[model samples]
Target: MKILFLSLVKVNSLSDRGIYTDLLREFVSQGHHVTAVTPVERRDSNSAKIEVEKGFTNLHVRTLNIQKTNFIEKGLGMLLIGRQFLRAINSNLSGEKFDVILYSTPPITLYSTVRKLKHSMNSHTYLLLKDIFPQNAIDMKMMKKDGILHKYFKSIERKLYNISDHIGCMSPANVNFIKEYHKYVSTDKIHVNPNSIEPIIQTISSKDRELIRADYELPLDKSILVYGGNLGIPQGIDFLIEILENVKLENVHYLIVGSGSEYQKLKNWCDQNKSDHVTLLKFLPKEKYDKLLSSCDIGLILLNKNFLIPNFPSRLLSYLEMGLPVLSATDPNTDIGDILEYNKCGKKVLAGDVISFKTALNELLSSSSKYQEYSNNAKKLLLQDYDVVNSVQIIVDRVEQVKFNQNV
Candidate 1:
């Protein structure tokens, strides 16, 4: 099958280890031709280019920088990005026809493009619902519910959902949330197709872990709780810092390694506190980051307490792949914590509940046997459920079913 994958992220290689790249690689491995349309957001210039890679073709459309920048600029860029992307696709791949169209969210501006592709090529459209946007924006107080911008984006969101033949949500909570609030979307159309990856099971020797810890200035004697991902508003950085400030666990060290809009805020708090128990570092290269991750004892997941939208973080897969037990501090609405608890691989604390967060950390530190059990469970669950191969099969099966129904 000829598959067209569209996303806002710039994916240069299918060889790279990411949610999209891993999934697309599986499609290629299954004898399907996958072409991805991504953005190459530039600050100084505006241009688009296409690159032919080994397993797939990448069409990089130049647009305004929308990530890690000022909110106003990103907002304007997002507003115009859909039109820019549609033009780029029509210009370059006008002759190409795809059997299926797959895309993910953040821009939610691709409704027109997907509609055009689905109509022109007679293709089935699948939406990988990674985000629920305007609501999330409202949760973070970035946008107001009755505001003009909010209403406009909500319309785009609805159109995107309406055009999708199938929508794959991250978890059951997401499925429920979408089905309940988005009554316009059929519940049968939404299924749990989580953030999956082609697992790279790399084991770390004890001595190697020690060496890496020493090199990275990480404490060898302490049980390290590492949070390695975007440190933005949605993550509830203030709550993360609050937990950090209140955590009195002497044996458990905190290692935060990521950069985003809230990096400076966290950095300021770290500098002012001048505590040796916490280490705040900028994002590292994948190899080094993975090494550091393997050296940690526990993985930390954070979400804003005000969230009405449930977020399923992809970072959970990374921690599970490394056999590290997760400890998520998230909003009450998110079901990631529930999933973790059900898998018996982690514990969850409500976001902003510093006391619970600290108690959970202490409990994990107190019981080595419990830690080992959780770690093993995490790895086992990843192998059983979150593999990209399984996710790819699910997506392909859905597409085939959609096609069959269309024929019937």
Candidate 2:
């Protein structure tokens, strides 16, 4: 099968370790031809180009910077990206007829390009629904409900959903949300296909851990709770700051590593407070970050209390990969906490609840036996629920079902 993958994520190489790259590599490994179309942001000063490797091809389309930019530029870039992608696809991949048109969301503006390709090639379309739009924007107070921009994007969202042959949601909650809110979308078309990765078996020796900690100047005696990912609005930066301000734990250290729109907010607080227990650093390279993560004892996840949409951050995989127990402070809508608690892998507290957050942290810290159990379970959860092989099978099974139906 020849697969066309449309995404906003920059895929410079298929060898990189990420959810998308891992999935694409699995598709190729399964004897499927994969062509991934992604953006090369204007900030990079790179022109559009295509690279064909062994069993995979990548088309890098030149576009305005859509990530790590101001709202005005991000919005304009998203709105214009569909047409830009379509033009590039036509110009370069005109002769290619895809068997499957697979794409993910963050930008719902790709409806035009998806529609065009699906019609042109008569391909089975699959939506890897990563982010719920317009509604998520409204939840963050980034856009007003019933406003012109909201309605416009909402329309695009619906069109995108309607055209997709199947929608793979991140969790059961996401499936329920889509079915409850969008009555027109059939339940049979939506299934839980989570953010998955090819697990890297990482084992750090005691000496290696100490070396990594010493190199980064991290305290060796303190129990480090690291939060590694985007420091954005969705993370509810205010609540995170409140936790830092109020927490009185002497033995527990907080290490925050990531860059986003709200990074300055975190940096400002860190500078003003000058707390010895807290360490704030900019985003590090993946190889370096993984080593740093392995040195930590716990992984922290923070989400805004206002979100009505259930967001399952891919960062959870990183924590699980390192066999670190997770402490997620997120909205009640997401089931990430439920998964953790059920698997005995981690604890979850409702976002903005400082007391509960502190209590959960203490529970994990106080019990050495419980912490070890959670650490063991974390790796189990990753292998059982979030391996890339499961995600590949889900997608391939769906495509096979479609082929059988058409032939019948």
Using TM-score, give the best candidate's number.
2
Task: Give residue 61's error in model 2 in angstroms.
Answer: 0.3
Candidate 2: list runs displaced more than 4 Å. Answer: none
TM-score, every prediction: 0.97, 0.99
User: Residue 6 error for model 2, in Å?
Assistant: 0.5
**What is the clash count of model 1?**
0
Q: Whole-model lDDT, candidate 2?
A: 0.94
Give the runs in model 1 whose Cα sits over 4 Å from its true position: 44-47
lDDT of model 1 at position 260: 89
Model 1: which residue pairs collide? Answer: none
lDDT of 1 at 343: 92
TM-score of candidate 1 to 2 decimals: 0.97
* Residues 63-154, model 2: lDDT tens digits: 99899787789889998998999999999988999999999997889998999899999999999999999899899998999999889898
Best by lDDT: 2
